[model samples]
Target: MAGPSYLVNILDSNHVSAPKGSVPSTTLALTYLDLPWFPSAPMQSLFFYEFPHPISHFMQTTLPTLTQSLSLTLQHFFPLAAKLICPPPPLKPFILYSDGDSVPLIVAEFTGADVDHLTANYPRDFKLLHPFVPELPPSTMSSDGILVMPIMAVKVTVFPNTGVCIGMAHNHVAADGSAFMHFMRSWSSVCKSKGDSTFLDEESRRPFYNRDAFGDPDGCNEEALKCYWHWISSWRENLAGPTKEISSVDKVRATFVLTRAQITKLKQWLTTQCKNSSNDSEEVKISTFVVTCSIMWICMIKSQENDIQVSTNGDDDDDDDTFYYLLFAVDCRNRIGFSLPVTYFGNCLAPGIIRAKKSELMGAKGIVTAGKAIAKKVKEMESGALKEAEKGPSNLEEMFRSGHHVAISGSPKFRVYDMDFGWGRPLKIEFIHIDDGGSLSLIESKNESGGMEVSLVLSKNQMDAFTSNLAESLKAF
Candidate 1:
């Protein structure tokens, strides 16, 4: 049966406001977290919110309010209105803000689909969400061949009586998930307060953009940049362009809700397993993030057993030579001591990797091993991991190109459900192009209660097996 689909009409497209008149152009140097995304892959997200009012009321009343509120909100976030400027060598990349600059705000409407089906937990055609996402401006190269791209673009689509979805595509170098959420929360706050700027909190009103604030005591930014350029140069052949579009993938996307009780059970089971293990020195500090991520990682790997068997050409199925890695990213705002504001906007994340052999992952201690690896990485972050990244050698290219990688995007800590743009909280929030490239989005469930919505894209067969394994494993817990 054909899944739901829709056509998007680009009703309006224009830029939002930025700092004008006598305000000197603001330039923010790229930090370590920002450098990796230099060539820029715009991360897109769709937030589905239920609107009780009729379509006319929304188009007439609500749309104007949202538009105005977003404009007012953007006034404070001028960088979103700006473009990334990378001059010729000897000049580092920075955000350039000038008068009349604005973010591209697109209003689109989608039709010919069932809204209920679109919002459901069951697997659906990932292509259905593509039209809602506005395309980012293509990257431009200077006469000297330095590349720069648009920082952000936004689209808001309506589904008649069903609901509305706000689609956003932003440069990762410009803002990490935390910074992005801060902007979004601020926009919603403005909308909820009837465009009252006064009601906004300090975090929203004042996002520290000082790139110098992060005391790169060990010159992590330079080291990271060097490592990044090296990786890019090596992968230049594969970097030509995206090989496949969203429609080319025969994949399904599903959002599985894991309640707090289920996650707690999983963690407890891991803790008990660790205690019974031979390694008494290991501390069982399995957190909700670690436990949930570990479970998903396990399920994903287990579900691919058939593929592994086929690829190995009848080699030992239990081969310890095969590689498996769980690539996760962490926000370093709090870990940097007192240098940067917790609300400091812009990229503040560094990647963390935990790898194991395929045999180890398929073993009984799989969950415990994965959990411990994550715990160790977390501890490392607490003890100057960011600073150490400068001196340590980088595997950025290898890790990215490795077929064994399963990365985590977004976070459960963001409380995305709390965002209310005057209508109500979102019914569902999912990454649009997650299927194009494989990555797991871990976000707080919309229920307000403690839980996680694990959203990912996998081929049809793998998705079915993954879902089945996920259910069975959680049931066992």
Candidate 2:
């Protein structure tokens, strides 16, 4: 028997720009925070909603509103429609926007696809979700060899009367999660109000693009450039080659939830453990994010314990000392010791890393161990979020070399489920790019308050192990 398949028909494709004369042509220099991710793959996300309308009705009414509202939103966020201009060595890259620059918007129809299955919490073929997302246009080389790359692309796939999926892909150099969510909310607000943006507050209506807000006291920008140069030089050929697609034949994507009650229970258990520990002099800051991530980290490691051991058979003496790293990004808007607006555009994030030995994470008190490491890292951020910003690239390089690492892709604070594009709140929201790396995505739960929705993509066997471990660990709390 043949495997499952999905059929997508392209109906229309066009570029949507800000209103004429609304945005001025300009160039924005890359910041230190954006330099490291300059050559990384674009971030892709999918938002699923129930339309319950005919295809003709959607194209006649819904599609036009989305495109028009997107255009209006672009007037305030012109950088999203700009192009990344990368020159040769000795020169820097910047975002450039010409008068006619626009973002590609694609409208398509997904036939014979079960929207309900795609949006369900159960495991499903991960590859089925790829077609809905729009890929960034191929980078073009100018006469002088400058690489011109588009910053963003959008796609809307209609499932007849069942539902619709809105997929977006964006270059990280253009903006971070906070800035991206702001744009999303602003666009949804305008569409909900029928193109009237007066209801939005000043902070929501406009983005702060002044790069000077990010103060680099330690000259981290210069150091970051040096690191980026080394990396780009080594990966230049791969960067210039065609995009590589990962095979998802035996891979499955699944959604898991941590209810508010379960989270509270886990936090209480960790607090008690900390109090009972012999080394009680040290303080451990615990939050929903800390506890949630700690448990997930433990589960992930335990699920892959066998594979980890086999990979380290050659060095049994050091198998117990093998290091595993958990990495996440922290927003620096308020922590940078300045009065920068929460709406500051572009990337303003610092890396938060937690390192532990394999034995520590797989021990009987693994959750406590992981929680303490994460809490300590969070507490250190209080002194200075970017105190060690210069070492970010080097630390990441070391983590990859170790081959036991897991990074986070999304934040629950983004509140993606709350985005209502005049239809209603999204039935489901997913960070599609997490499949590219050993990363998991977290978002605010759609049905439960103070809860989190965690999504992961793993091999079928590993997923089964993870699910079992997750259930057993949660039951203990």
Candidate 3:
């Protein structure tokens, strides 16, 4: 499958536009939302272990298996993801979230390369992957006015031992993390089961994220839904305050395991700290995992210097002491209005945010406050769920008036554990950068040996601080 392969291509001029819909006309801003909002756009982190160690058999090829077709089996379960878009989702609708006139989907492209091709041929070290022509043709697009593609067509390259990585980027309006993972697995499952025809039948199109389980289109008022739109608009601009795009070395990834005793002590400490505190009626229970993250970031910053630094890589930039710490993700199965069970279809549900500054999060009390703050914000998301989004924000527009400054974004949506293509869980789950930004994920589960562990994937510099600070922070209580 080399030069001009048998793939569909949907060029912008040849494609149709999103069909007219009833959704609202107002642009939405994540910061403007009345309640705390998650991704201004729907995004996710997917983890996969290097093909489980059967050591005897493993190889990486662009197209792993010689199926009848070169296009991914993704066409099987998530054709929407890998196909091209004709009529793109309108740009204004996403203004609240993306902050730009262009759709993130069309702005990005997917090009595949063998890991060896990258290590040996590329002029640059294996740091980034760029866009290229798409294969899907014009037929895949819909007439809708929105340029929403269930799946973004991507070229997949194999990593001899690491398995295949299929690049996917879509309109943030369409899918979130959980939705993306379900889509990713469903897409790959079809590929692995090439011999089997029953994997993703028409029945699989059940609308997992909507009230209906089938391919039924939802009937909520599109304009009324902007209530959801305007709310997030305010959250981004108003309550969250302005975003600052500080520059720093890329944060890296790391993993650490803790004893049940260590986990318990940390949890106890946080609970006790919240005891006398008067915040919300909701119990101050904390996920041991969230505590680990706060500790991770604090240690991350401390190891670097007495205070965190924030520079936007600008030659004329001022003040270098601004930094923010992010907490992991939470499942929105219940958070969103969709009451359907967490199903195995296109992505469903959404997430909320948990952020703190470097100075405030330096010491023990600081970590506790940061973690607790995350819990509180998520809890707000729990109680209000969709309603909060309808309320909108008073101070929202000011935040993203300019397109810069988003600090550490964290997510703990680990779906690698739930997916099983018959080969049991893989040995290691790692995330490759598909998006430009600082991202951190926290997982709470047993490792390959059934022991507790905390794994972090972040920018390179953050990794150094995290390791040194973690060693000391872990010793503290």
Candidate 4:
């Protein structure tokens, strides 16, 4: 029942390690915290495409396109290269394509021997909730990013198993998750096509990797943001909850996907019903992710109630009735207000919060209310007109202290979408085991049949719910 000892150690490391610079130059900073004690869980071992057909070909044609894009991108954001620690030789890494234009392919190769160790943890280690993001229950860890660096003692006896961690740690600094995907798509096209991507129009690509989002000017009164940060930062301490208990609580986490078809339809339907003014010039904006999250949050919260009434939730006997925050990661690296040149990389994401009382969530519009809150939070984040996750200095870590309890998470979106390291096109793309603080990571998977295939790690019950939803989705799609 005790989680790995490394858990506390790594978490502590992130809290105290301030950025080398007291002031974060860019809106984001990615520091390598030594995981003296990383949360130990299931270790995955899988192969991309063993036979290796067009992988080399894919890499040869597409690597330059990506590297070139990254190089040009870095010139925009000066410190990006140092963050990723890219070798001077500028090694051209490979990328993978996704099932659709939305997903990505990651190739993670591991030794077969390690399979036993991973299998032992299986659903538990892989699906358990994150220890730090206590509101999320255990399963949230699965969907978020993972931390895998053996205790430095136990050597994972796996062979031939490997995986790709997020590569943006290097070039393409300002590419938001969306733009990153765009770049990946281009790489995939080059890998799958007969034409050359070497001639891509540099101007055609949108400007991303900018550093101004953090300090962008918008309606957010600096006083208001500072106040909110102080209030919210203090509030986070009480909500972290007790130790992670994987068994009873329903695992609550988040996911990011395009508006896709079905969810988009649902949003449109809801738009017609909302009494809110359609008068806004931006139009009635909604997305599949919003709709899906609304529905899921409703179900999880409502599942606690015998009826839709809020008070009824407290009387419920079920153990899974606990309510966890459904936090969505948004990348502010590219929002319009950001003035920093493209190529700024690091963790340029912010968490969108939708809080729900255990019982009130069962109300008919509970999910809808939560969804709106999510949208509203996102709006608040980009108050400066830049689509940043929050309104604050890029380097908030400068103020970090040992006793300070802060919750941060982000979406490493669209990283390996079109990576082609000259080995044909990468048959797979997956981020390596990476852990910073309380972070939830989602990366593309390697599936021959195409479509999106992802591997998430979460706590127990939350993992159960997540898997249940995933299975349902697989069937529905």
User: On residues 1-477, what C-alpha lDDT tens digit does candidate 1 reach at each position?
Assistant: 255545666666766674356235677777776766655457788888987666677778888788788777777777887887755444576788777777788876777887777777888877766777777766565576455657778888887777888989887778888998888988889899888866444554567777776666567767656745664455434423222354565777888888988988988888787667636475747788888899988988887775555567767446576778887777778675436676788877766777888878888778777887777777777756565345334655666566777888889878888899977888888886466536888998777476888998877777888899898888888
* Global lDDT of each candidate: 0.75, 0.83, 0.40, 0.34
Worst lDDT run of 10 residues, candidate 4, spans 147-156
Residue 357 CA displacement from its true place in model 2, Å: 1.0
Which runs in model 2 stand beyond 4 Å of their true positions?
1-3, 199-205, 231-244, 278-280, 307-318
RMSD of 2: 2.3
RMSD of every candidate to native, in Å, equals 3.0, 2.3, 10.6, 13.7
Evaluate residue 85 in candidate 1 and report its C-alpha lDDT on the 0 to 100 scale: 71
- Against the hidden reference, what TM-scores do the models get? 0.91, 0.95, 0.57, 0.44
Q: At residue 447, what lDDT does model 1 achieve?
A: 78
* Candidate 1: residue 390 lDDT (0-100): 51
Q: What is candidate 2's lDDT per residue for 202-283, written digit by digit as tens?
A: 7645888888866665787787677566654565555342243786447888999999999999898998887686385887
Per-residue lDDT of candidate 4, residues 305-396 (tens digit)? 32323346546454334444565555544465444443333334444544545444545455455556555566666653343333333323
Per-residue alpha-carbon lDDT of candidate 3 for residues 199-300, written as tens digits (9 for 90 to 100): 445464433423243221232234333444454344432332222332343433355666667777877877777766646677755766556665655665
Off by over 4 Å in 3: 1-150, 159-171, 188-261, 276-282, 300-330, 335-337, 344-351, 354-359, 391-413, 418-424, 433-437, 444-462
lDDT for predicted candidate 2 compared with the true structure: 0.83
Candidate 1 has an lDDT of 0.75
